[model samples]
Target: MEVKKKLLDIVRDTVRFKHYSLSTERTYIHWIKHYIFFHNKKHPKEMGKEEIEEYLTSLAIKNKVASSTQNQAFSALLFLYKEVLGVDMSEWNIQALRAQERKRIPVVLTKDEVKLVIENLKGIYNLITMLMYGCGLRMNEVINLRVKDIDLGFDKVYVWDSKSLKDRVIPLPLKLKQRIAVQLEAVSELHAKDIKDGFGAVYLPYALEKKYKNAQFETKWQYLFPAANISTDPRTKIKRRHHILANTLGRNIKVAAQKANLNKRVTSHIFRHSYATHLLQAGIDLRSIQELLGHKSVETTMIYTHVISEMNKAKLISPLDF
Candidate 1:
């Protein structure tokens, strides 16, 4: 028990040293704990590729986990061996029975449906939806937007450290420019109030806190979508305002969808999917869309092509028409 606790402590310290997100750190820890416990609390140092494979296969066969979930566990184990335990996992062949992958199409809304849902949302939620559809932003990207990220003069929105881990620039929608400007003004005001109350410091990613010294207290670095009230930072125990929770954004989207009476399922990511499909339907090339969406590969962006093809199928005439 003491050994496992000490190992997790090392893992936590290493993850923080590497500047991984809090959520990612937690996920890695969760999977690592599951792996250790599944093998009768055997220390990961005593295990190898075969044990890893067995555990992953159990996730597929017994737990019925999703393919992504299985991959997540694999990554955590890989990190445990390579980063924490300091073992060479490269030579060991791991042959795990993977969870079945389903190739279902992403759910997308029509442009009109997007409008309908947006109409039902108010204030920040409305703007969030616009950015997701207009800029093809992931929910995290939208929530993580800092004041400095918006280039109002240049009509650009800069997405930094997104899921792809690649920073990219997206064109700001002309219609939402004023809305975003208003949002910035609101954020600045809220930040000023927080500072006057002696708590304006926002969380900085990675070593930026060490590098910038005062960047955490800067208005430009503050989250554009600040929480309504100040909260305690779980990691630092600092009383600071964080960005709006993903759950808050997701819940609002659901409520808006219910109000809109739209038949299609709606989520924050559905807007992103709609954005890609809409761009494709407008004859934008896949490469341009790939860059705009910050996709690492054009193949990832190519999913929109399948969506387009499926939509076009509805327009095809039956054999009787020929």
Candidate 2:
């Protein structure tokens, strides 16, 4: 009989089997290891609900972990006990720190400040910043763009399998047509060079690799923002250029914000906030903005209303006028 896999290996197999994202898998494993180590390397199978509570309380009291981090640990443990270990944890009273509810308005850029920020960014970075502001793409949405996902004729960009595993359509800005074509040509050259080096396959999501034998080699599925160099895939050991990391955009935007001398905190997400607020300023209905922003509820999109036009202005009537 084959020996049963170790705890971490079993968790890995379970996460992959459920098609969780790579980041999520890493996070779950990290928390599981921490839980075990906190209890002096005790196996999870030997522990029960009380041990889980003690570990979580230690995090809040000793480590002083943020409410969000505490909750993440809770969720990771919940998944481990319920899903992986086949334990019934629903009856366990989890007394972890609750995440504080925050209601701060999102930061929005004026039209001209956006123009200044865009002007400071050059080449591919500029195009990406434009998409963030112009089309309301999340940072991951832009980085993971495949060549086949864009349609210039219809002026739309298809954002696929994004956060919450929901896909939506974003309108392509007219100004970006020529710029995107140039970008495509540059990417084509890079791809050709990669092919020459016997390394041109890109990662596919949800078993597309099994569905289409040559999907990896097809340029249609290639990352629009291919990385500067190829690297070995952790799962398949194939060398392919993944999309440029999202941190590159954050770092470049910081520099650009400094160069523009803007006094507000600026990040790639600011562009997305600006996208929603600007639309609201132009009298776009909440429902339309909700759909464009790909928010599951109109309430999430309504936050922009608090930041735009008359909603933000102070107009107190004078007693003398009365």
Give the TM-score (vs. native) of candidate 1.
Answer: 0.96
Indicate the worst ten consecutive residues by lDDT in candidate 2. Answer: 94-103
Off by over 4 Å in 2: 1-3, 93-95, 309-311, 314-322
- Tens digit per residue, CA lDDT, model 2, 1-322: 9997898988888888887777889999999999999999999999987788888888888887877788888889988988899998778776654455457799888999999999999878988899778998889889889998888889899998887567888888998888887777788888888889888888988777889979888888888888887888776688789998888889999999999999999988999999988898888899999888888888888888888744556565578878
TM-score of 2: 0.90
Show pairs that collide, candidate 1: none
* Cα RMSD for predicted model 2: 2.8
**Estimated TM-score for each candidate:** 0.96, 0.90
lDDT of 1: 0.92
Model 2 lDDT on a 0 to 1 scale:
0.86
Which sections of candidate 1 miss by over 4 Å? 1-5, 317-322
How does each model score on lDDT? Answer: 0.92, 0.86
- Whose TM-score is greatest here? 1
Best by lDDT: 1
List the RMSD of every prediction in angstroms. 2.0, 2.8
